[model samples]
Target chain A: MASSDILLSVRDLRIAFHGVEAVRGVSFDVRPREVLALVGESGAGKSLTARALLGMAPRGATVNGEIRLDGSPDLAAARGRRISLVPQDALSALSPVHPVGDQLAAAVRSVHRVSRREARARAVAALDRVGIPDAARRARAHPHEYSGGMRQRAVIAMATLNEPDLVVADEPTTALDAERREQVLRVLSEQREAVGAALLLVTHDLDVVRDHADRVLVMYAGRTSELGPTHTVLGQPRAPYTAGLLASLPQDGPRRRRLPTLPGTPPAPGELPPGCAFAPRCPLATDHCRSEEPETRELDGRLVACHHPDRIPDDTATLFEEEQPA
Target chain B: MTHLLDVRDLVVHYGTVTAVDGVSLTLEPGETLALDGPSGCGKSTTALAVLQLRRPDAGEVRFEGVELTSLTERELRPLRPRMQPVFQDPYGSLNPRHRIRDAVAEPLKVQGRWTEADGPTRVAELLDRVGLAPSYGARRPHELSGGQCQRAGIARALASDPRLLVLDEPVSALDPSVRAGVLNLLADLQDDLGLGYLFICHDRAVVRHFADRVVEMRDGRLVT
Candidate 1:
């Protein structure tokens, strides 16, 4: 898609909490009608970046750098109607006291001046769109009454009630089962198509992103390590950390040897190493990587921020080797 | 080999809601049986009932030929060490204020097997077995990453020397990459220790990889 078709553009976005930089200078774009995945481990600043985009960052947090949304609309200034968040925990996100329908209707009324009756009708329709079998009845049920999958659907319905231009879904399918996960993902995909909205899907599941996201961004230690088309980035990751992540997933069938694991844990924000934040865990880190930070450079239509942006030659072999045994 | 756990016709109810209906399963020694199903399909409830954490309205939960359901809380206190749970949210499951050593040592302490002299050594060994550095025992839960916390949870579960470990969505909260490591660790631990696992999860991929047999559930009933 062309640059004009982009719904959101982030450049050198930095966010810090109490002098601890949670999100370093990170840049990416979300195109209209596209699913862009922000893939990273926990504490990698993915959630923080998503929260900053929707102006829901924690109190006393400082956000810097450029964030441009479509039509000159300052996303930070926009209300929930323009930009909505589908939180990770569906159980906690929905209020236990109120009926799900009432909660959804409130979202619809927030954006448009609608009567209570009209909002309820719209809420039922939204639930129906998300494939809640008995949408009308489900609308009247409280959060506790609904199953985890149904609760997630309710959350999605509320998020899309205003037909927001952008939706930031953080680990939306984490708590769902396999079948329910597929259903929830399908609903998300359908919503993106029907509403023609850009989606910033922040998740740790590569399988979810591999099939759903058109573009992918890899984040580590609060910085964007790699960004490119989903297939290209996942299939042939240039960064060592990205390659390690891809190597670590269990194959579809059976395997013989032990699964590959990254060496160490991600550094805490306050204790991040001076040079490259991932140097400690990165297998290909050199003395230079521990002394100077790498800059993002374009290589084959993808942005990679590594001093050695070469693909791991043995990654595919190592992954496949374990699949075959004598 | 005798079954480590035998759950027959397990029926658990939450008020008027039947969370687990007539669920029957068995875990043999050194085998991992995965319970796969959609959310709210009684998988978790079944796990809880097996551990007697939830009172089953009907059914029998027998561990090593002993009926667990018939035991009162006080009577079942000692049985706790024989069966342990590795919860999904490792961060939440472990106490933030306690060091990893203390979290793992809690089970031993509760069982009165933990002495100050041997607790540290045992904790270090458990951490090493779970692929964590011995030094990690001194660090608190907040100091470790999600995957490490999960490993620590597994270490704690193993510390009890349990014959059966009920792992509830053990790796669900972890990243896909880190997930494999934990799965492999569980598989290795089971093989080495000859432990039986009631592996409850929603991910088909992980189930297929780690489970010796798969049981599917739907709406509080077993489909397969």
Candidate 2:
């Protein structure tokens, strides 16, 4: 992770809607050909962070951040060209009426000035690269006509068509079935190298995060809770939010009476409590945690925003039992 | 108890395309049968056919040993009360205009399970059973989160006192952290109610954890 190898660097990024901070002081970097995952529950600002990278933040939002794309120092100028976005909801991400091929060609032409025929040809190649079979014929089909998985691939093809230096895919595998999820994840991992672009995969899929992502950034209530290599983070999460999330996942072992859930829902952006927003829900929260926000600190090899970054002992059952839903 | 739901050689066609081809599955009381597959693999069409939302081109759907395929809509009304569906998109499936209380009680009222007094009480009880607070009964679908709306959807379906619940990707719309809660709730509900479930989902991991029997579908047919 050399500085120069980083394709996109986000420092002290803050996004707010109507004076409500949705993403507050989040920071991370996406390195070339690396797959980095941003994981969190809804309202954790993962989507907003990804949106900010593409300069596609919703209307009436105040954003202040230093986002360096390919060392260019500004994402606004690089978005849709050096940087690309593969949005959630493939059906809606694509134009329902337009042929998938034409939409992809439009994306290609957006970055590079090319003839319609050349762009269409490139679009077909891109679709084929993503493993959409019968690319030429399928590209001719409308978004509605293509299957759910195909629609996702077509969208992905459009994102990576220009071989952008950075790609931010928001919930790419969501709303898809197991096989299709695997297919989409495979396409993303493959395309990261083939296109030589860094991937900022924003998803809640822990399975994918563990298997596909090189590094992981865990968010909680509009803040960076943990940022580390996937193995280190998922294997031994230092942040209570990350640990609680891992603890809550239903495993293949035995079925529990109820899931080990983090108490209370994520705070709404505007209504977020003072101090650490997650203090109310954190099992390890202290008096200090309730009175003051925890500053991001360097733990062994990662950044952890927690008063107690010491790894919780692996009592397993008791650790899960301690955090009963409030 | 005998099989609560039984499907035989079910086939659904969309013109020239065979959406669900010769698929057969059965559900025993208190058992969860997960139909796991990718998109466009006919898992949904099979669920729809089994629920009689759509007619099958071939094969039979029998509920409690009675043939559902040949029954007319009017004739199917009584039997319909024994089978209810919890759909995929809670935001889309739950009526935006109706409050949770009304939505849940509507099913009971349709089935004549309540008089005036029992309806509200029953709605409250159903809401409680689905882990929703009684206060939530007053809120509309739009006021609730995705998980809350899904819980309301489940509460509505449970209002019919159905022995079989056809849950179509019920937790897929929910956030991952919320998904476990819903799944645990569904599993708990099955234990308490002795409900049979046709859990149609694409997540194999979920099926492995939740389903007693899993039938994987690929391209309109079962792989195993």
Candidate 3:
């Protein structure tokens, strides 16, 4: 992570809706050509933090702290041609009434001054880039006419039409099946390689992040709980919450009847407890964890927020094996 | 163990389009059967048909030895409590304006088994069982997270104490990290209560993890 190569930098960012802090002082940096994943449970503010980068926070939400895009003061003031988003729900994001080709053409024309015919040609090329089999025929179809996977490809096509510097994908593979998920991820990877754009992928899928992301950030209760290399954060998590999450996944080898779950639910916005937000559910919580919030500390090159960070039992194999009954 | 719900040659047609065609399956007590397929493959239609929300053009739905296809909507009203569904989208499934307590108690009320005196306590216990706080009973759908909403949906589905629960992509809308938690919760609930589950999803990984048996569907028909 060279400072010169950094494309996006978020520092002490906080978001509040109706006086309730949804994202509490989170910070991370995205390099120019690497994929950084923000992984967390629902209500962890991963999506909110992504939206904050584009100044797309919900109405009436108050944002504090700094967000610098390519060293710019405000992301909203940055050229629209530079930053783009691929939203989660492709069906809802795309207009159902219009032809898919027209939507892509609009995106093309919005970023570049081109004739309608030229924009259509660029749209077709973009669709082709995303591996939609019949790019020309599919371009003429409406959003509803395309399959769910095809519609998602079209959304990606639209997101990359302008060859933006940064692509923010929020749960891009939520409803997609295993095959379609692979296809979509492959397309994103190709786009990153060809265009040299930074990717900020916000998802709940640990497998996707582990495979595709260069770095991983674990968010809990609207804050960054841990950040490190994908393998370290996943394989040997330092934070108790991250370890609990890893324990809960059903991996390849075996299966357990019940995964070891972190007790208690996600804290509601504006109601988070003092000290560590995860302290209530963390098994390693002590008096220090309950009274004082731990600051981000560098341990083995990864950033972790915990008073007593220790090694979690390497029960991955055992837990997974237990999940499988004879 | 007796089969709690059985579907044979079930077919659902929307005009000429066959959403679910000739699907057959049987779920035993305390078993979790996963129905998996790509989008538009008719897994949802089969579940809807079992609930009698979609009338099948052909086939029989047997619940505890009783055939449901021949029953009219009026006759099926009582049985509705015996078989309830938990949908994927909790926000859409739940009435946004209704409090969690009211939403969870609605099924019991519809079955004419709920009274005002015990409704609150039952709802509280249900919320707690689903990993939500008892105070969450006062919150609306919009006030909770996607996982919490799904938990509420599960709690509501369990309110009537049904023998079978049709989980239609129940955890699909959740985050990957949260999904494992919910799936574990479902497994715990099933083991504790000895409930039968018809879990419908498109994710193979989830199906392999949560189900005792997996049934694959394609174009409204079972492929395997």
- Top-DockQ candidate index: 1
Task: For model 3, report DockQ.
Answer: 0.48
Candidate 1 residue runs with Cα over 4 Å from true position: A1-3, A71-73, A314-326, B13-18, B55-59, B70-75
lDDT of 2 by residue, A90-171 (tens): 9998888889999999888877888999999999999999988999999899988988888888888888888888888999
Model 2, residue B53: what's the lDDT? 92
Q: DockQ of each candidate's interface versus the true one? A: 0.62, 0.51, 0.48
Evaluated with TM-score, which candidate comes out highest? Answer: 2
User: What clash count does candidate 1 reach?
Assistant: 0
Candidates 1 and 3 compared by DockQ, better number = 1
State the DockQ, from 0 to 1, for candidate 1. 0.62
Task: Give the alpha carbon lDDT tens digit for every residue of B122-176 in model 1.
Answer: 8889999999998888899988888999999999999889999999999988887
* Per-model TM against the reference: 0.92, 0.93, 0.92
Query: Model 3, which residues run further than 4 Å from truth?
Result: A74-79, A316-326, B116-125, B128-132
Cα-based RMSD of candidate 3: 3.0
Residue A235 C-alpha lDDT in model 1: 82
Residues B1-224 of candidate 2 have per-residue lDDT tens digits of 55788899999999999999999888899999998877788989999999899989899898999999999999998888789999999989988999989988888777777798777888888999998989998899988888889999999888888999999999888877788778888988898899999999877667778888889888899897
Candidates ranked by TM-score: 2, 3, 1
Candidate 2 segments whose C-alpha is farther than 4 A from its true place: A1-3, A70-72, A254-259, A315-318, A322-326
lDDT of each: 0.85, 0.86, 0.85
